[model samples]
Target chain A: MTSSNETVSREIQLAARPQGAPKDSDFTLVERQLGQPGEGEVLVRNLFLTVDPYMRGRMNDVKSYTPPFALNETMTGGAVGEVITSNADGLKAGDLVLHDAGWRTHALIPAKTARKVDLLPSISPSAYLGILGMPGLTAYAGLLEVAAFKEGDVVFVSGAAGAVGSVVGQIARLKGAGRVIGSAGSADKVAHLTEKLGFDTAFNYKDGPVSTLLKEAAPDGIDVYFDNVGGDHLEAALFAFNPFGRAALCGAISQYNATEPASAPRNLALAIGKQLTLKGFIVSSYSHLSAQFAKEVGGWIASGELHYDETVVEGIENMPGAFMGLLDGKNTGKMVVKL
Target chain B: MTSSNETVSREIQLAARPQGAPKDSDFTLVERQLGQPGEGEVLVRNLFLTVDPYMRGRMNDVKSYTPPFALNETMTGGAVGEVITSNADGLKAGDLVLHDAGWRTHALIPAKTARKVDLLPSISPSAYLGILGMPGLTAYAGLLEVAAFKEGDVVFVSGAAGAVGSVVGQIARLKGAGRVIGSAGSADKVAHLTEKLGFDTAFNYKDGPVSTLLKEAAPDGIDVYFDNVGGDHLEAALFAFNPFGRAALCGAISQYNATEPASAPRNLALAIGKQLTLKGFIVSSYSHLSAQFAKEVGGWIASGELHYDETVVEGIENMPGAFMGLLDGKNTGKMVVKL
Candidate 1:
């Protein structure tokens, strides 16, 4: 498909606001006719569409860090695509680009808003949507910058097998963390975290109380925590933290789908005696670290010091299922839809 | 009382560890034989004893920032006293001093551990136990350093009529805060916070839910929070916080005496979207700021630009009752026992 008037694009739209957990009927697939790129715009065919946990927040018609996805309109997110035509300087046809126009088969984006990428054989275009992308940067900045991770500091990360947590554990291990502990939802993911991801210890949070499991894993206490799954995991981290402990709160996947308010982590008062620092942040705030992150993380990937996994759901129609599955912890790492 | 070998001192001892809220039976007044100053020691007669909320934490038999008060022993805390005799190089008779040896009418302490103070007609020695002492430094460091308070930022503080919170609100106002909001338990304390302490707005927490009261008090949202009373107050601050808000978790007076765990502030997950930073700290960790705090807060007091109130309980026999009253919000500003 090129930037011709005959080209057609299939996009997913929010059919209804989800009450509890989103179902198939909450989304509607629509096909729209494509037109040629206008001035300072480019037409691209999306190769991979990113399905992230944060997307669930956009599904609701509520004010947030990002605007809510309009009902019956194409929902937008990160996508890696091959540009078919460009009407702007410095961008050309056949160039691969990364942009936020996903949940669709194609995108017509402003040239300035689309970032051109190098096509490498060792890495896939989808890597831009996972490791070496937002999730990877989230981990890098959340650990090194936000959490103030230090050498020989014991590091604990929840959602250990997910995209951000996987990167966080590996980076801590590579950067000489005294110990790295991870918590996942499944035994397979727990095994993957310890065996493949080089976490010093891994536990399935579903097995028992998170506080008990975390205390058993990190007997000496953790100095830094990279929180991806909130709720009990955060409360447990609070219990397992040593004096002056730091936690970078990135996401709360456990509470994302809840219709009722979150009620766990009641032990937040423990922070006082322990003198803990809990900082919550969005990855977008640390865009200044993108270059440094790419260089360091890219080097780790190239040298095989870091590893990443992708659970790809083929076809644009399965994007919603992939996203819902991602939230349900069905994916081991980054969940993406290949169109 | 003047450092005689035959002098007797009246002291209060912790008879038993209280299960919940401490009572009169938990303490016992004792008569102890006093001795003259030994080598490098000073014998001081107590003038005032501080009764603070943190004493509640020390009453519980648990490992914490401060050790629990040993059973059947004289309880120790901040005291301002006048030295009668000294056996150290720079010591002299009739010198007023500050030391950590309260719950007693007299103290025999090392001269190095006792800080001599100027007996100013404008300020009483008791000011060293309240506005010009540990509580003063706590408010200064927690607001300016821990919370990273900035000029023109909206500031909200819980327990705003207490020693720490009153100072926190006044300092913020003096330093050009855009707005200052305070919460106290009683209507009188609320009125005192707004009318006397210069808080732009004040609310009695007993009026309604803290979140609703806070939202009404700070309509534009708070940029900084100095939390003295945690639990629901923290949850309310979380809801009233603007993006990138910072909270200094100094104390959790609300949950200190609770036999069970705290359950409020369940909405801490909101920190992620708001990009909030909550840091819990102890005043001892910030002793490096003592000189600066003294210079600033002392100047504010001397210039009459800042005002402080103290609820003084007569006699050392009422010390335990004063401490219990402090926890119950029976007094405004600092609660001290005048001996």
Candidate 2:
């Protein structure tokens, strides 16, 4: 018999560091006791949890932009949930908030760390973990700011069916791009990119060599490339770029699970004669664009000019599965876990 | 005997396309007759010819930023000469001018294609072919504009004893750089880089692995990398860069003669987490900075604050040999044929 002031919560912990591709044995679900909110703190009942590709880097103990996840400790990520109890100003029990306490059913966090999210009519709380969140902002900043995209430019994006890449391709089209091209893993995703996402052209990278496929798809050459899948995709983009072309290197999902180091992009010397610019950036550096992003992207969503997709997995116990599936390209768009 | 209005000229022509490293058999010395200057034309007595690494690209039959050299035709490059006769208003007899009619003893060219050079007492006319000319502007624009160099940056220059790299290292030091490090092919050039060129530290790339050498030289990491030798040098720079580091992809002399494609810079994926910016540029695209470059670099040379060196290879017939020698890293600075 638990006390009324105490609650039992189930949270996911890192059981072991992944060797290459993560396995079910690498994560474990553990139950913990949580007390009522202390001063300036709130008890959150997590409704949605996000599993992004970047988390793969955090599982490794190497030094990177973000610290690695500790072994046997609860992992943290993006979450959207309702405030169950609050001892903080401007927060109440029924209010919804976006935070970084994901992979768990509940979190007791400082109020300052949680941002109150207003529940709109049609948008679900899960949207805060996908289209209306980090992935959306990454697409906006990487394309417009990092890649320096201009109207009427030919744009190519890799991993076109994934969360960030799908939005990148759509945004390029909506922004008056002359032609938008995409490369994905499957034929259905290729069709989905062309027919549903408004991509002028799309190809299944598994069909043949990316360079030959890219050359056939973009005969005139591409001015901008939003690189989500690295390795062969990056090498192909380098070969297909026209002079003065620019590429925004956002992620390398293709090499994330590989035990061996990536070896493509052998034609980097071509950059010298082509006068290309390849800039790598993370979305956190561009948080200053959030207000402006919310305004522009929010307007597009409201008018039904922009489209978004999500693959939701049920239960906190399945969060690790959802994350592994996300890395394996099992999800078409943003993969989120629902409590 | 030749008439006053007619002259016999000796020129070098491309005999065969090189399979890999260029050799003497790839060139042939030929004699041709030149007529008097026509309208807007001038007859020039060539004084010096430049042998640069970029000329190796023109030897191949591939389409690049510049057109490939035609087979059995006179090979053209940067040259400084004395105008013997001028039908154009701006040029006069005995005036020193710079033009693109190299690998020859004499040339009949249009005045519009030639720029008159002002000969100073202390500066040699051949300086226009090296330190005071294209290579200088390449170093100037590449360091300041392409790399976006600032005052407190720790800079690294590969091929630091070569024409452009030497100037690049010197400029970085004069511009208040926090530290300057350079890598060369030989022990003597390495010593010259640190002792004569004001580089804070220098290393002979042949000693060991470039990554290990660079790590030993730059313990704190580098902010700007002016890459002249690509391949392993570029890969090392990528690993040595700090957060938000920038690299101006100036040249890849190491791979110019390679029959196979280069496979280094294997660590380019590090750019994502480090937020690196790698921009490739050509000197021709930055001609707008010429006047500024001349003023600043000219001032530094005049005050004896900057130093430049040249390897003078005598005779027009030796141009092919000099060019081959340059590719083999036989020259300390600019390699010019004194005709």
Candidate 3:
């Protein structure tokens, strides 16, 4: 018989590496007793959790920039939290912070892993995990540096209503790009991209062939392509790229959950002919650009030049559902969970 | 039958668009009378010609950095020649110069395309067509700027005995790179890369799988990958890349002649995991860096810090065979033809 004080932690862990598309069975939620924080560590009451596409890659045991999560450990993710009790300096009762504290109710993290939030200026704490954080920096650095955006350059963005993609389209326009076009999975998302985010043109990728839609939207050809969805989206971008065009490959959300390997690009030969520059990048590679990113994106947000939306789930237990919904293109913008 | 004078003026024209790999049947050599030089023009007696991998991309009727080769017109290429007649003010007869004069014995070209060469002072005239020309600038700019080499960084070169790859490996060493590893098709080519070209380690790609060879050569991990052969070589580099590794993709000889579509890389997911920066480039994209290239590389050759080789065929009539050999990886270095 279990005692009343012996509480269950109720955390999810990687059960097995998926061969292709991940299923619910790949995860196992376990209940265990919580451990107390040791020296120089703080116990965080995780308030808001983040479910991102990058986590899907971490589930695989392949070698990458960051190490994969081992089986039976709590699944890793970004989270915003309140420090309940602390042994670390400068952190006190009821102070909010951002950290890579996994999917759980509470965590005991080293002082260094948790960054104290200065919510003194009245910035929303949830925004620290979304628009003002990694996703915003990703859009800024990938578009400006990797894509080499110049004044009057026509830009095209794929998966344009998602977390990073929405910010990418708006940032390109703010940097003086001439015409910005976007692609989304649903009519509502497409409408949001154009009506809410100021995208010049937007298309529902599922409505028709992307090549036909892209040609009609970008008759002059695209100077820069910020790719989030790979597969047919990349092929269409190839056909639509102008001479000396640049492509910033940020993600391939379309192929992340594929049961079989993705198809080879039909227009692979065009890369050489057009003298195109295609760069694959991770946000962490340009971490030095963070201060510059904060200043520019923060100013843009303050001046109403950039806008963002978030889909929030209220409980930590719903993170798996949120992640699955992200893969299915269900969320309109950045997806976060309120703990 | 054609007269010798008519043959001298004639040129091979694009007769049919190639569906996959180009064949000799796609060209038609015809005879015509040479035209006189107009104002600001010089008539060149073409002495040498360059055939490159990028030319293969231009044979198809597609949009590119430069316009596609027109049907029933001379195929465009860079050439070195003697000025037979000059109506341009700054040029005179008997001066050696270089220009984009196409595949022909003689051409009337604008003075702007013709840059005067002082072959009498230092380097051989053929050096202008090989080491001191476009291929040289390509190696210099792409390696130094795009790869971002630092002293002690380990470098790997694919197609290491080829024109650009040979220069890239040598320059990396000259710039204080710790170790230079290279891969070529044959044992003789491998020996040349190590002994003559000064690569620290050289491997015959045909000896075994590239992944195994790469692991043995770069046990510590590759800091930079200069990719000239794309398919398996790119995959191998991805496997061996260290964190923050940079890949400057200059060419993809393995995929150029592929009749069917190549496979999608199974290891592409590594780009995000390792934070690897893989950038595709055409040399001309960095034209602003040309003056700096001329100063540095020009000095390197003058001081014997860099060495280059050319595989030259005796006559322009053998151009097709030479090009075929290039596609088959027969040349040891830069492939050129003497007219």
Candidate 4:
């Protein structure tokens, strides 16, 4: 469809706080007039939007590292876009940049907030929102630093086919981790982990008990457990942790939407007994390591040691459905919306 | 009491496993004759015995970093003793040393296992079990390394009048922490923290809600939290933690004897939101830093920048009661038994 220059901008806003699982009514789509880019600002035509687990925590009104999205305000998210107009110095019109432009077709953002990407020689610009951006950094920092992985250490990644997990398993292999095991929600995802991501062993969490499966997969015991889905996965990893083991707790997707309080890990005391170190971290905390991460992870990808995948949903209007599917484990790899 | 040499050879063993908390019935005070020290071994007459929270986790028959105390076997603990007989070249009969000797009056230990403490003109040998040994090293490693304290950061210590907490608060203050707040179970203990240990503020947890008191004590929010008593104290610290705060999970005494599983923290998710780091550590993991710790903490103690207290119970026969009392929060600082 050809649009006039005076056409209104389409946007999505938070309608209500979710009780347990978010419903469609929790978000509302509305239209507003597009404004001119102010000084030191660029106007972008958003091409793709990202849906992630971390966004669920942002929807709640409770206090967090970053403020919660105000009710009725535009729902915020990371997006990749092409600059339509620029008053900013470095960025020019038609340049592809990654920014937290929220769930909208067009955004006027400060130039500093947008990172200019050279999508020519390395990879596609969408990878910046998926494997090469927040998700990739989450996997790299959590595994390398928080989990303290050394070569020959047995590593396990839960939610193996998800954005962060996929990258975590691949990075573990690249870092010479021994016996990289993974768990996914479906058989297809499980196969994808071992076949595509180079995981030594992969289990479908829905097929059987997690503790039993973890034992079968990692017979000797796990040294580093990268947990995306917490609950039973955490309990299993704790039971299977060897002495001096480490767990990098990046996300606990399983307990995020629970109406009642979640149960404590059955073997939580094992942390002290095994002298294990369990660290809960967010990717932003280690942002200072980004340049180093890009150099290392980017090189690994170039060498074919690291690989990534994305599940794209067409159009900005489908953002809520895409996010709902993400929480339901319906999407494989990084889930994004193409507008 | 000076007695026949034969009387000094008796040892104590575990007779049975206690159902909940350990009981005197679980101990068997056997009178086995002493054996001659092997080559590179020494005979020790135990002086001071350590009764710590970590021992509680070992009471159950389970795999841990250190194996559980076997039924009808000696219960191991850190002890300071004087070498009575030595076949080792480096150790003499009068040398004061520390070793992992059990609940016994006498022990035959390998020379390498026994660490000799050259008695300082101004310090007592018993300091090895309190301010200069495991507890002190624990405080140093957890506070400086795990919590990553920088000058002017506000610090909060739980179980603040106990062994590790007392040292942690003093060391943080010595390191130029802007404010040091502590929480204990009673008015006397709270007073001890503020008056004797240099805490900027101290509160009796029994007074009211812990989160409320913590907020009042640390109005600007705590930058570093040294957690010794987990459960409510941990929850309170999480709420009062500042942005980019660090939490050192040294011990969790409150949950040691819970008959029923403890409740999950209401604000546990805050760890991710505030970009907070919660690191659970055991002192043995950082044993490599012992010499560095000794240099720094020893200097602090000698210069009067740090102070430590010990709650000594006399006689080896009273150890069970001393241990039970330690769990009951009766001890002011390091709970040591002088035999």
On DockQ, the leading prediction is 2
DockQ class, candidate 1 = high
Highest TM-score: which candidate? 2
DockQ of each: 0.82, 0.83, 0.39, 0.38
* TM-scores, chain A, per candidate: 0.98, 0.98, 0.95, 0.96
Candidate 4 per-residue C-alpha lDDT over B81-175 given as tens digits, one digit per residue, 9 for 90 to 100: 99999999899999999999857888888989998998666887778998999999999999999789999999999999999999999989988
* Candidate 2 structure, TM-score to reference: 0.98
Alpha-carbon runs more than 4 Å astray in model 3: A1-8, A35-39, A87-89, A118-125, A145-151, A259-261, A265-269, A272-275, A285-306, B1-10, B35-41, B86-88, B110-112, B120-123, B264-266, B285-305
Write one digit per residue (lDDT tens) for candidate 2, span B1-339. Answer: 568778989999999999999988999999998999999999999999999999999999998999999999999999999999999999999999999999899999999999999986699998998788999999999999999999999999998999999999999999999999999999999999999989999999999999999999999999999999898999999999999999999999999999887888777888999999999999999999999998899999999999999999999888899999999899998999998
Tens-place lDDT digits, model 3, residues B1-339? 444433246576788987776678887777657667788988898888888877776776665566788999888788898998899989999999988875777888898899998773566677776677888877887788878888999999999998889999999999999999999999999999989989999999998989899999999999999888887788789889987788887888887777676564445545655667666678877889878887888888888889888898867667767776887888978888888
Each prediction's TM-score against the native? 0.98, 0.98, 0.89, 0.90
lDDT of 1: 0.92
Which lDDT tens digits does candidate 1 get at residues A115-204?
Answer: 999965679999999998999999999999999999999999999899999999999999999999999999999999999999999999
Residue-wise lDDT of candidate 4 within A261-283, one digit each (tens)? 55656455556546677677888
**Model 1 Cα lDDT, one tens digit per residue, B1-339:** 555365578999999888788999999999998788889999999999999899888888888888999999999999999888788778788888999999999998899999989865589888998889999999999999999999999999999999989999999999999999999999899889888888999999999999999999988999999999998999999998999999999999898889887887878888998999999999999999999998898889989999999999999888889988998999898989999
lDDT of 2 by residue, A41-132 (tens): 99999999999999999999988999999999999999999999999999999999999998899999999999999976799999888788
* Best candidate according to lDDT: 2
Docking class of 4: acceptable
